[model samples]
Every structure is written in structure tokens, then in C-alpha cells.
Target: MRRRTMGMLAAAAVAGLTVAGAPAAGAVPSAAGDAVTASVWRNVALTGTYTIRDDEGIFAAGTYCNGNVASEGWVNEVRTPSVWWETTCGGEIRVEKHVSAETDAGGGVMIYVTLRFYEGTNDTNTDLDAEYNFNRYVPA
Candidate 1:
């Protein structure tokens, strides 16, 4: 009889069925009240080799432009000093992101930019130049 009673008590203790009605071991608390803040806004400019593959376009060399970025998107603009022989020139902007254990520095980013300048006329009779495949990125 004593052995049976002790077995029942041990089983109850191991199953967390004590006199109280709280949770058992390894119980995790909910984190539904946490909040997050937005990152800061920044602007950067990059300058490097700008080239066009097939079609010849007149883009000036040795010029740089700044990019204004916000939570949504960014814009890039440039003015070539002088148009040279039909050449291609521009820079690209890329982003590299990482996370830190400390104050969430969010790691540094690397941006590459390419800018190109092309000339064309609105001649209706003849074949006028056309630009295509322009990719613009926007934040979510």
C-alpha cells in the first residue's frame, strides 16, 4: 500500500499536477507587447566606371551624383559636363545588410551606381532612339 501511494505521488509530481493549476516546466511566456522602431534615413553618392554594351550613347565621364533615400524609395540624377563620342557611363547602387546582437547597428551597406547619357531626336520620318528596361527599386 505504501509503495502504491508513493508511486501515485511521484507520477503526479512528474506530470506537474500539483495542488496548483499553473503551467508545467519549460513554459514560455508570450511576447505580444514588444514594439519596433524604424531605421534612420540616409543619402549617399557613388562614382565609378559607366559603360553601355551594344548601342552607343553619349555619356560624359568623371561626374558624380547623390542619391536621396527614404523609407520608400530613392532617386538619382546627373548632368554631364559635355557629351563625348557615343559612349556609355553610369553607376549602380546595391545594398548589403546584416544584423548585430548589440544595439542593432544593422551593419553597413555597400552601394554601386551606374549612370548613362544618351542623345536622340524626335524625328518622326526616320527611326528615333528609344530607351527601355529601366529598373527602379522601391521599399516595401
Candidate 2:
């Protein structure tokens, strides 16, 4: 009886460890995955819709286009709506001058572009760039 009880306890301990070590089903596996799920941008164009989230939940969502660029003397009106990114006037976006040194004949270059999402027009800027290798996260 003693030996049988010991065996049962061992089994129970192993079972508990397995259960505790496993990830919760459907849980976001990593910070990057949680930040941008492929499901969130289904078939959307780079100019149509994009979204970014953080551990606190969705930080920004909006549209973008190369054609929507600024002229030499005016502020370009580009908006990125992020409910939780910053303070939230639906947020805003400012794309810096493109870094062209890295481009090739294909015009495909990887860049770590920084974007800001502000709470309101009066709020200070918040960096909305991805913390990880977000180049892969962007849809082709």
C-alpha cells in the first residue's frame, strides 16, 4: 500500500507540472503576435488599413498612402486612429523622409521607420514603432 501511494503521488506531480507548463489555449504566443495578428488586416492594402496593438490592447489603426504626402510648405493631413496608443484624438501620423540608401533595383528596402501616435493635438508625441522585427509583420 505504501509503494502504491508513492507511485500515485509521483504521477500526480508530473501531471501537475505538465498542465502548469503548457500555454493557455489560444493565448497570444509572443508580444509581436499580440501586437499584430494577421487576422486583423485581412487583404487590406498598405494604403487602406493597418493596425498595431500593445500589451495594453490596440494602440493604433488607420490608413496610409505615398500619395498622401506633404508639400514643401504645408502640413500633410494624415491620420492614424489609435484608441489606446496615446491620449487619443484618434491619434496622428508623421512619416519621416524615406531612407533610400538601402533600396535596390526592386525598390524593396527594409527600414525601421518611427511613427508617432498622439492622444490629442495638445498631447506630447508617443512612439508607435514596433518593438520587434516588424518588417515581417507588414503585409505584402
Best model number under TM-score? 2
- What is each predicted model's overall lDDT from 0 to 1? 0.24, 0.24
Writing each residue's lDDT as its tens digit, candidate 1 over 1-140 gives 32343234223322331111111112222345455433422232222222222222245233333232111112122211221112221332111111111111232222222222222332122222232111122221
Clashes of 2: 2
- Residues 79-136 of candidate 2: C-alpha lDDT, one tens digit per residue: 2222211122223432222111122222222222222332223224554332211121
Residue 69 of model 2 has an lDDT of 20
- TM-scores for candidates 1 onward, in order: 0.20, 0.21
Once fitted onto the true fold, the runs of candidate 1 whose alpha carbons sit more than 4 angstroms away are 1-35, 38-40, 46-105, 122-140
